[model samples]
Every structure is written in structure tokens, then in C-alpha cells.
Target chain A: MLPVRAGIGLRHPHHREFLERQPPIGFVEVHSENFFGDGGRDLDVLGRVRADHAVSLHGVGLSLGRADGVDPAHLQRLARLVARIEPAVVSDHLCWGAIGDAHWNDLLPLPMTPAALDVVATAVSRVQDTLRRPILVENVSAYVQPDLADAMPEAEFVAQLVARTGCGLLLDLNNVYVNALNHGFDAQTAIDAMPAVAVRELHLAGHFVGPDCVIDHHGDRVCDAVWALHARFVAQHGARPTLIEWDTDLPTLDVLLEEAAHAQRILDRTRESVDA
Target chain B: MRDALAHWQRAFGAAIDGAATLPALRGDAATVARRFGVYRNNVRLARMAALRNAYPVIAALVGDAFFDGLARRFASTYASTAGDLNAYGAAFDAFLAAFEPAQALPYLPDVARLERAVHVAWSAADSAPFDVARLASLDAAAQAALRFTVRPGAHALVSRWPIAAIWNAHQPDAPHGFDFDAASPPYFALVRRDATRVRVDTLDAAAHALFVASAGGAPLADALDAVVAAAPHADAGVVLGTALRDGWFDDAPAG
Candidate 1:
């Protein structure tokens, strides 16, 4: 098994470079939907990468928040991919991206009410049963609060979800940072309340600061505050697998590796402190 | 909660439409509205960007501003049905066909169709190329009776306008002095991956006819006859030879 060190989100731009020189990182992750096709350059490149490193399948779609039943076609495609890739970990966001037949194509937030919880938990449980594996569900960075949601805090909602479903948690420290800043909450408090045993992975990505909100854009380097939260997460969780995801305007491979190395050093230091 | 979900959905829709004030919800209404708005923006941006990426020629034909407007309108009207954004723009060609503003550009629909084909081909499933050597071992009669399937990722696109030529000229390294009118009449294009790069080839009349016939499961002899009939002046032997060499066929014709 690959250790709990920093990995980079493998985007198309960096595919060729990684092929030529397999960089030294903890592991690599790719958007599962990107490889949903049968045969193509995307699949070809991904196949090559799988041969060389431990890969994690991160899904952007799957719409776990929808009130309707899980999309059978989407689950079938994901199942076919899991059989083929045999990834170390598989994950999707806790937010919904589709409603009935209409897909919004974005990670839309869910109401934290009991009704919404039942809907999302049922969806996640169905997916886990189908895949016969405990998939990790990542907390999405939200921009707004719905009126019908239960007054419970986001951390309490997440904890409730972990208790209801056996699925592991993919604690996105960056999302915690973004939501904390946007909604005027403490990022550390959210992290501290996370059910530590349910957390199997961590994600640290950059966000785009908008006029009214800080968006989880994943298009730049991890911010200082997000890094600090990530370090704190490692201290709390004992070095779970962390991924540095940069989707748009991706920098050179060296720059991404440097970011990963920074995270790796933090994890190493934390591990040393624990041993001492 | 149900009402709240509906309200959030509507607010998200309104926000994307550039509405100023969203309806108040139950929780932190302001925060909910803001988050919903952020999602709306991301949805619009991502879907429009996918359309632009898949249909670059359409974006080029209609300037960036016009394309952006069209993308936004299309996204709001045509609800995406699949989890994958790549699967979002299937109706774009038909949408373009009926779009009032684009009606003047009669060729735009066909161009959009070709672009969709290229996008689909780029993401289609992988399959092994047909084995020519294995086919050579079959008896002549069996060969004539064979039914061959095109590779899963291979797509045949036929358009009345010179759309493939338009697509080819937009390649990253295309020559600056290329002329669209210099290209011949309506042509058939075979879009498929050659190793890693997506390669587009303008198929002759006979090859196109053969591909269409074989795609419909016609036997080799019947398909060859249709090809010869479609382009009486073209050489069927050379067309088949080229197609076989290009990894277009998926298997030996079924006897």
C-alpha cells in the first residue's frame, strides 16, 4: 500500500510528462468520469499511469445528494471502471450534482435537514452496497445555507453521516478552509469535530477568491491557511493519504512535486513527533 | 425540506440567469443564496467551457461573446441528463439547427454535428484493431460473406458542407493561408485515435459508403457493391486496403 503522503491530481496536460518521467510522489489520483469512455487517449494514458503507481479514483459526478435514486448508468460505469482500475481508494463529493433527470454539472450543496440526510445517506449506502466497498465521501465547500436545513452545525451533520453510513470520510481540508472563510466559521473547529475513525483520506487544494465567496477552484497552489489545516489534520488523523489537486492553469510537474514534497515533509515530521 | 430543495433549485436557476434578489430560504437564507449562486456560476462556467472545448469551431464562427451567450442559453434550456459533462452537449447540433439567431448560418448545424462526432470519437471505448493477417487465412467465399464491425472508437461523419475542412484548418499547427473554399464538395470523414493523437481523415466516396454499409451490418460483398455504386469512378480495392491498414475495422467479416 502507498503510504499516507502527498499525491497530485493527474490532469491531461501533465499526462505526457508523467509518462516520460514518473515523478516521485506518494500516489496519483484522477477524476473517474474523465475515464468513463471505452477507448481513447484518456484511457490509454490512465492505463499507463496505473501500471506505474498507486492510483485513486476521484469522481466529480455520481450526484449523491439527489432525492431521486442513484443513476444506474452512472453506477454501472463506475463499477466497470473499478473492476478495471482496482484503485486503492474511491471517492465522490457529499453534495448532489443532479436532480431527477437534470444534471447541474456542479457540486451543489445539500440541506442539512433530516430529510436531506436520509436521501444522501441512502444514496451513499446504495453505492457502497453496489461496489461492495466502503467508499469515502468528501465534504463539499458550500456557498449558501438552505432554509429548510436542520440548525445543526456542518460538523455535526458530517458526524451524523459517518454514524449512519459505514463509508469512510475524505476530509477535504481545503473545503473546510473555503467554507470557514466564506461562512464565517472556524476551519479548525470543523476539523476537530470530524469523526477521526471514519476519515481514511485527506484532500488539500487551492481556491479562487471571488468577490462574495472563496470558491474551491482547485486551479492554483494550496494556500498557507489550507496547508496549516492540512498539517493539523495529519496530527489528528495520524498521516492519512493526502492529495494536492490542481485542475485549471496547472503548473509544471516540478512545481506540483514541490507542493507534494512540502506536504510529505509535514507528515514525516508529525510521524516523528508521535514516535518521540 | 422538499419545498426548500425546490426553492434552492429555483434560486440557483435564477442566479444563473443573473437575477438580483433570490427568494429567502429557511436556514441562513443569505448564505444559502450565496452558495447556490456560486454553484450556479460553476455549473454555467463548466458546461459552457465543455461546449467551447468540444466545439471550438462553433466558438470561432460565432465570436467569443456570441458563443458565451449561446452556451449560457443552451445550458439553462437543455438540462444535462448525464453525470459526465462530456455527455452534456449531445443536443447542441439540433439546438443550433433550431436556434433563430443561427438560422442564417445554414452550415453551422452540420459543423456542430462534426464537432460532436470528434468529441465522441475522442472519448469512445478502446478496442483492438482488426487483424489483417488473420483475415488473410480465411477462404475467399468466407471473406466475401464476412461482416466487419468498425472499431468502437471509430466514427464516420458525413456533411453537406465542407465541415471537416473547416475543422482541419483549426488545428493548433494549421497553416495560416489555408482556404476553406479550395476544399472539394461535401465529404465524409473518419475520426479515430491514431496511437494517442485524434486523427481525422477525409474518406473517399467508396470508403465512406463501405463504412456506412458495414456499420449497418451489411456483408462484405453487399457493402462493396454499395461502395462501388455510391462512387462509380472510385477504386473499391484501394479504399478497403487503406481502411484495413488504418485500424478502422474491428474484426473479420462474419461468414
Candidate 2:
């Protein structure tokens, strides 16, 4: 299991340095789809890195909220990978990306209606059953808000998913912050709605404020507001396995390490408070 | 997949694909379109990036603008069947073959094929070296009828254009004025991952035929016949020896 400390998302650029240095972090998270290949350099790197450090298989595919259902082929590949790696944690976004024949390969937002809730819960339960372990479902950053008239609040949708499926929540504070600004909701209240103990992991990433909406690009440093939100969450719910996720315009390993160190410091402070 | 939620997902997918105008999702039409554009942009950019990653040589040959346009067309023409983005552009070479604008560069399709092969080899499965000892232990008759399994990441590509030379020309350390004759002999390339890197080794027709036969599950004797048929004057024994030395076949028990 992942330690309740901080880790960095391991991207391609840092594979060599990450393996060589074996940085003193809690664990390293990788996109599960990236290593789904039968074999190759990425799998080799993952195997080597996993030998020493804890690993988290954060997936972008699986389309866990697909109305039709989760793709059995995709689920099988994920199961094969999970069996091989036995990662500290496995998670995918609570968004749909495919319908019928096509997969958009992006975390498209799902409506928060009861039917959509049933779709997500069924899919999540199927995935957990296949993997023989519960998986965490993360709240995706949304650009287009669903029809609020027919939909429940995003927090309630997520809470019901957890209560129904017995899965964990990967509380992405960055997504929470972005969605709050875009949809005109209070981020703190959204956090408050979650079952606190069900938050198995926390995600901290940077987003771009687009002209129309706040985009979850994950291309910059964690913003001050999100950091404050994270601190508040930790102060209230105690520490979780937090990750520093940077996907585009990736900086050197040092930048990610520094960010991870910052997160570790927050986690450490929470421990100190608990001790006192 | 026609439940109410599925209907909504399909409509949302259509809007993202530019198939249908902004569905009356939530909010006013203008406001909805503006917000929905974000998903469209993200999908296009992410899929385009996958194609760019798979076919860097093609991107370099065609400038970024042209390549981006081609990628957009290809993304629309072919549905992405795989959840993994890396597997998105397998049909790009086929698409480029009939692409109107790219027809000017007749060799572009072949180059795309070479790039796809390289991209695949970069992460293809690793296998143990061919077991020479096991092969030797077989009696003469058994050895003659042995059918070998091709190793993962080992592919033999024969193109009329000098695809290997074209790909090498675009490499980071390639010569400044590298050129190749379009009329040159067909290029037979063996693309394989050797522990550290995927290398493109140029081969004679006889050797190429041998590799192709092995990939097709032809017995050793029939593969040797294929080698002789491809190049009447070439030595089949020498070609087979080269294939063995290169570890083209997997060490798994032969069929």
C-alpha cells in the first residue's frame, strides 16, 4: 500500500534519472495505459523502479462511467497489469471517454444523473471484481457543466458511487478547485461532502485558466489556492497518499522532487499536529 | 448502447467529433458551444499528439501545419479502437497512401510505415534469444520441418522506395545534405529491438524472404526454398545463419 506521504508522477523524460537516483519519495505513479504493452522499455523501467519504490497505477482509459459498460478488453489488459505489478494503488477518473465504436482518449465529463450514477457504479464494481481489489475513482476536472436540473451535485454523485460500490476516492484537489471556479461552487463544501476516510489518495496538479473555463492541463506548479485547499483537507481529514502530477511542458526531475518534498512537508506537519 | 445516458454520451461524442452541432446539452446554445469546444480541442490535441509521437519521421517530412491537418483528417476518418493512445495511429500509413495532398511525396506512405514499425518496436515485448542448443539437439528430419516463431518487435519490411535511408536522413545526427535516389533498389529492412535500441538493418532480398517466411510460420526447408526463390544466386545457408545470429526467432518451442 502507498505510504501516507507524497510522491511524483513518473513521466518518460525522468525514467532514466528516476531509476538511477531512486529518489526518496513515498511512491511513483504512472499512467496505467502507458505500460499496457506486452513488453518493452517502459515496462522494463516500471519493473526496475517497482522493485525498490512503491508504485501507483493511475489509468486514463477504462471509461469507468461509460453508459454502455466498461470495455472487457481494456479491463483484461488492466487486470493483467495489476496482477503483474501489484501496485500500492490503482485508480481511474470518474469520466467516460468512449461510446459505441470510438474512444476519444480524453476524460470527458459525465452527467451526474441517477442513471449515470448507476452506469459508473456498475462499471466500477465490475472493474473491482475483475481486479480482485477495490480501485479508487477520481473526480475529473470538467470544462462543460452538465444540466443541473436533472443532475445531482458532483459530490453527491461521487459519494453514492463509493457507498454503493465500496470503492475508494482519489480526491484530486486540483480538479475540485478547477471545477469549483468553473461551476461556481465552494471547493471546501465539495470536499466536506466526501466520506473523509474513503479518500485513499489525493492529487495535486496545476491547471490553466482558459478564457472560457479553468482547464486541468497539469502543466504548471500547484497553485496557491489548491495548496491552501490541500492544507485544509489534510488538517481536517489527516494525511493521504498525495501525488504531484505534471504531464505537459514537463520540467526536470528536480522540480517534481521539490514539489513532492513540499507535499511531504504538509503531510509531516499533519503528523506533528496529531502527535502534539 | 442506446440507454438515455448512452444517448447523451453519443451526442456528446458527436459534438466532440464535429459530426453534429452542439447538442442542446445544458445552458444556452452559444454558451454550451463555447464550453463544449474545450472537449473538442482536448480530444483533437491528444489524438494529434499520439499520431505525432508514432510518426515523427512523417511529421518531419511534412511540416507541422500539413502534418497537423493530415492528423486531423486521419483522426476523423479512422475511429480510435484502442484505449491506449500509442495504438491510435496504426492505420496512418494506409491513410497516407490514398491521401490526395500527400500523393506529391509518393515515398511518404512508406516512410510512415517505417516510422510505425519503429514506434511499435520501441515498446514491443522482449524475448529470450533463439535457443541454438535446442535447434542443434533436433535430428536432421525434425530440424528440416521445424517452424519458428518470430520474436516480438522483429518485423521485415520491403518497400519500393528507400524508406530506411529516408528515415535515417531525418535522424538527429544525420548528415546535413543526406540524399537518396528514388530509383534505387527496393529497401529490405529488418526492424528489431536489440536490448537497448530498435535498429533498422538493411538486408538482401534473400534474407528478407527468409525473415518473411519465418514470420509466416513456414517450415525451415520451405523458408530456405523461399530464400532461393527470392534470389536465385544467393546462398540460403548464409541467410539462415545471419538470421540465427541476429536472434530473429523466439526461443520458444518450435511448432
Candidate 3:
């Protein structure tokens, strides 16, 4: 199990520093697809780092919400990696990325309807069975809101998925914040509807605010609102394994460690209050 | 509604592919188009980034605006068939070959091929190194019949253009005053992975033939004969010795 502390997403630029310094961060998360090669420097480096730190295999290519079903070849590669790494936690986003044989290579939002819910639940179950362990499903930031008249709330869809598949929740707070802002909803309400027991992890990342919408680019520092939301969730739901993700225009190791240090402070505060 | 979900995804995909302007999404038409534009842009940008990562030299050869347009056209024409982005750009080299705007720069296609080879060599599966002592242990006749295997992703490409020099010139910290003359002699590149880095070495005509023959599973004696035939004055011993020292060949496939 991952500790109730903070971690950082491992990017390519900081691999050497991570190997050499062996920072005191609680764990490190990596994009599962980046190391999916049969063998290479990325995989070799991941093996070396795994010996010292707790690692999380966070995936983006699973396409867990696709209507056509998950890709078997992708699942096979993921299974191979999991068998080798024995990661502390495995997780992927709740988004569809492909239709038929064409892959968009971007996380596309799914319509939050009953039919869509069934598709996602089945896919999640299949992935859990294949991995032989429960995996966490992260809520993605949606720019295109599903306009279906009978569309259920995003929280309801996720809650039902957890109940049906016995899967855990990787509650990405920044996604919640971004979606709330883009779609005009209450962030706290979204957080309140989450199945508390199923939440095994939390994600904090920065976003780019565009003309029509806010983009979850994972490129900047976490905003003040997201930080407050994270504190509230930790205080209410207690602490989970939280991660700071920065993907584009990556900064140095010191910056990521500093952000993680801030998260650790929030977790520590919440832990003390709960203990008292 | 099961059909509707799939239908919606299809329409949405069409919009992303630039086959249609916008899907029948909810909201005002202008607002919906504006929002949908974000997804369309994301799809194109992500695929373009993958191509850029694989062929940095190609991008460097053509400026950003031109490369962006070329990548956009290629992406729309060839849909990525795999979830792994690494597997997405294999056809870009071919796409560049038939591109009309890029005809003046004929070497671009070959350079793209070399870049793809470098990427494949970098990520291909690991293999055991060649066993020198075991070869000595074999009887002379047994050794002559032995067929060698190069490490996974190792490749030999002979091009009329100076593709290897162009690729090397674009690398960071590459020496200045590189002669970009298309009139220079053609180059043969032998791509191999050393430790973690992919090395692209220029080879002579005879050496290239030997590598191709050996990599094609030719018997040791037959491969050497081909090398000797290519250049009568070339010393077969020295050529094979250089290949061995460079960690080119993996252990011969089991019996």
C-alpha cells in the first residue's frame, strides 16, 4: 500500500537526478506507456528507481471508457510491465481515446449517461480481472460537456463504476476544479459525492486557462483554489497518496519536490487533527 | 441509446479527423464549434509532438510552420492504429516521400527513414552480446557454417544522399561548418545501440555489404565472401574485427 504522504510524477528530464539524489519524496508516478518498450534506458532506469522508492504505474493509454472495448494488445503490454514492476498502485484516467482502430492519442471526455456508464464499468472490470488486483480510476477534466438530456452527474457515473467493479478512485482534484469551472458546478459538491471508501489516491496539477475553457495541461503550479480544495478533501476524507504532476514545459527537480513538500504539510496537518 | 453512444463518438471522431466541421453536440452552434475546436487542436498537437520527438532532424530541416503543416496533413491521412504513441509515426517517412511540396528536398525522406531507424534501435528489445570465446571453441567447419544475429533494431541503410551527415548536423552541440552539399559522396549508415545511446556510424561500401549479409543470417564464410567481392582490395578480417569490437553481432541463434 502507498503511504498517506505526497509524491511527484517522474518525467524524463529528471531521471538522472532522481537516480542520483534519491529524493525523500514518498513515491514516484510514471506514465505507463513511456516505459512500455520491450527494453530500453527508460525501463532500465525505472527498474533502478523502483529498488529505492515506491512506484505507481499511472497509465494514459488504457482508454478505459471506450465504447468499442479496451485494446487487448495494450492490456498485454500493461500486464507484462505490472508483472515485472509489482507497483504499489495502478491507475488510469476515466476517458475514451479511440474509436474503432483510430487512436486520437488525447484523453477525450465521455458522455455521463447510463449507456456510457455501462461501457466504462465493463471495461474497468475487465482491466481489474486481467491485473488480478483492483485498479484506481481517475476523473479527467472535460472540456466538451455531454449535452444529453438524461445525462447523469459525473459523480454519479464514477460512484456507480466503483460500486459495480469494486475499483478504487484516483480523485484528481485539479480535474474536479477544472471541470467545475468549465461546466459551472460546485467543486465541493463534486468532492462530496465521491465514494470516500473507494478513494485510494489523489492528484494535484496545474492547468492552462484558455479563451473558451480551462485546459488541464499539467504544466504550471497548482492554483490557490485547488490547494484549498485538496486541504478540504484531506481534512474530510483523511489523507491518501497524493501526487504532483507536471508534464509540459517541465521544471527542475527542486520545484517538484518543493510542491510535494507543500502537500506533505497538508497531509501532516490533517493527520494530526484526526489523531487528536 | 447504445447505438447513439457509438454514433456520437463516431461523429466526434469525424470532426477531429477534419472530415466534418462539428458533430451534433449540445449547446449553441458557435459555442459548440469553439469548444470542439479544443479537442481537434489537441488531437493534432499530440500526434505532431510524437512525430517531432521521433524525427527531430526532419523538424529542424523544415521550419516549425512547414513541419506543422506537413505533420498535420500526414496525421489526417494516416490514423494512429495503436494506443502507444511511439508506434504512431512509422509511416511519416513514407508520407514525406510522396509529399509534393517537399520534392525539392529529396533527401528529407531518407533522413526521416534514418531517424525512424535511430528511434527503433533505441527502444528495441535487449539481446545477449556476441560470445567470442564460444566461437573459438567451435571447430573450423562448425564456425564457417555459423550464421550470426545482430541485436534487435540494428540496421544498415545505403542512401545516395548524405542522410547520416544531415542527421548528425542537426544534433545538439554538433560541430559548425558542416558541408550540406548534396554533391558529396553518398553515405551508408550502420545504426546500433551502445549502452543506452543510439550510434549512427558511416560505413564504406564493402563494410556495408558485409553488415547486410551478416545481419540477413548469411553464413560466416558466405558473408565474408560477399564482402571480398564488393571490394577486392578490402581485408575481410579487419572488417569483421571492427564489427565485433563495435558490439554489432549478438550470439548466433541457438543451433
Worst 10 residues of 2 chain B by lDDT: B20-29
The TM-score of the first chain in every model comes to 0.96, 0.98, 0.98
DockQ of each: 0.56, 0.63, 0.67
Ranking by DockQ: 3, 2, 1
Model 3 chain B lDDT-worst window of ten:
B176-185
lDDT by residue (A137-246, candidate 1, tens digit) is 99998777555535466667778888898788888999988988977888898789888878888888889998877888888899899888888877876898888888
Per-residue error for A216 in candidate 2, Å, reads 0.8
User: iRMS of each prediction in angstroms?
Assistant: 3.0, 2.2, 1.5
lDDT for model 1, on a 0 to 1 scale?
0.81
**lDDT per residue (tens digit) for residues B1-255 in model 2:** 227778778878888888756544666677677888888888888888899988888999999999999998987777788778989988898899999999999888888888888988887878877878888899989988999988888887888887877788788888875566657678888888877577787788999999999899999999999999999999998888888888888988778
DockQ value for model 1: 0.56
The list of candidate 1 runs beyond 4 A from truth reads: A149-151, B1-35, B60-66, B100-105, B179-184, B252-255
- Pairs with backbone N, CA or C atoms under 3 Å apart (clashes), candidate 3: none
Ordered list by lDDT, greatest first: 2, 3, 1
Q: Mind giving the per-residue lDDT tens digits that candidate 3 earns over A1-276?
A: 787889999998899989999999999999999888877788889999999889999999999878888998999999999998999999998888887988898888888889888889999889889999999999999877766556888778888898899999999999999989888889989899888788999999999999998999999999999999999999988999999999988999999999999999999999999889
Where is model 2 chain A poorest over a 10-residue stretch in terms of lDDT? A143-152
**Candidate 2's residue-wise lDDT over A197-254, tens digit each?**
8899999999999888898999999999999999999999899999999999999999
Model-by-model lDDT, in order? Answer: 0.81, 0.88, 0.87
